[model samples]
Target: MPFGGEPPQLLKQRLLYQGRRFSFESSRLRLPNEQEGEWECIRHPGGALAVPVTPEGKLILLRQYRFTVQGRLLEFPAGTVEPSEGPEETIKREIEEETGYRAHRWRKLGEYFMAPGYSDEIIYAYLAEDLELLENPPGQDIDEDIETTLMTVEEVDRAIHSGDLADAKSISAFMLARPFLK
Candidate 1:
């Protein structure tokens, strides 16, 4: 009955964390063969990323230290989508918050799972054009230390090929955007 039985089905779910921003839960389920199991899953608010294009046709990138990766990474402007907010609204807010730039037009590039194996977090990628710099710098989180870098599309391409840019989201977004380049 190892592989022949049907998969598990959720029977009951209990809220674990119900904060002002997010909520967490634990699910109890019954397998096809009558076995019971429990799984913990978070109902994330989702997120968005912005591949911002400068007025000079350059891409705006950010270099920051990712604790989970134990190293610094070069990535596009991105942030978590607030509860009850649309993807476009999230991207616009994230771009402004991370890079201090306001995008006039936004094109949705694609959506992907951050880590499909473990979490159900979905991230929507976007291409932002017609940008304007904010008079004030972005107000980063207290623990966040990010440096913004403006690079030409060619520079980003070279970095990807040279192993300088290693973040998955950045690489994927850049690849998706390659077709639009001249």
Candidate 2:
């Protein structure tokens, strides 16, 4: 047939790695069109990002070393949403925990599926304003070494133009928040 028959349907799923906070699952599916007849998939919980803006039109960003990417990257403060937590609440908590800043105003910017071809991770982006600095908590994740900085909108624009700020999440958030800029 031109449509190549119906796509595969999930048949079974089992957890591969179950951490204290998150779990990864392996799934089994049956494909009618494929001669092999069966396939496997990985399931993962998604993450969230907070694009914090200062009153002076600067964006609060984080610089950290990512082991997977094997480099330091500049990005907005972000984290995975804990179970039973809403996106706004997760963003608020993540911004404070990572950047030592609390936002008074929060606006839902947008959402995106990060690599829908392979993973089912959905990222929720938010715009935060009216920031106040606070003391950072100790015993943060050992692998997390983050430094916070504020960049003007013009600076961000320049980075995007020059191919400096190339992170997908950062680029998406900046584009989504462009209408709010002066």
Tens-digit lDDT string for candidate 1 (65-94): 889888889999887787678888888877
In model 2, state the lDDT of residue 16.
73
lDDT of each: 0.83, 0.78
lDDT of 2 by residue, 19-101 (tens): 76455666677667643333333344667898898778789888878887898788988887777887777788888888778
lDDT at residue 38 of model 1 (Cα atoms): 88
* Reference-based TM-score of each model: 0.79, 0.81
| Candidate 1 runs further than 4 Å off | 1-8, 14-42
* Runs in model 2 lying further than 4 Å from the true structure: 1-8, 14-40, 135-140
- Candidate number of the best lDDT: 1
Go through the candidates in order and give the C-alpha RMSD of each one to the true structure.
4.8, 4.4
N/CA/C clash count, model 1: 0
Q: In model 1, which residue pairs have backbone atoms overlapping below 3 Å?
A: none
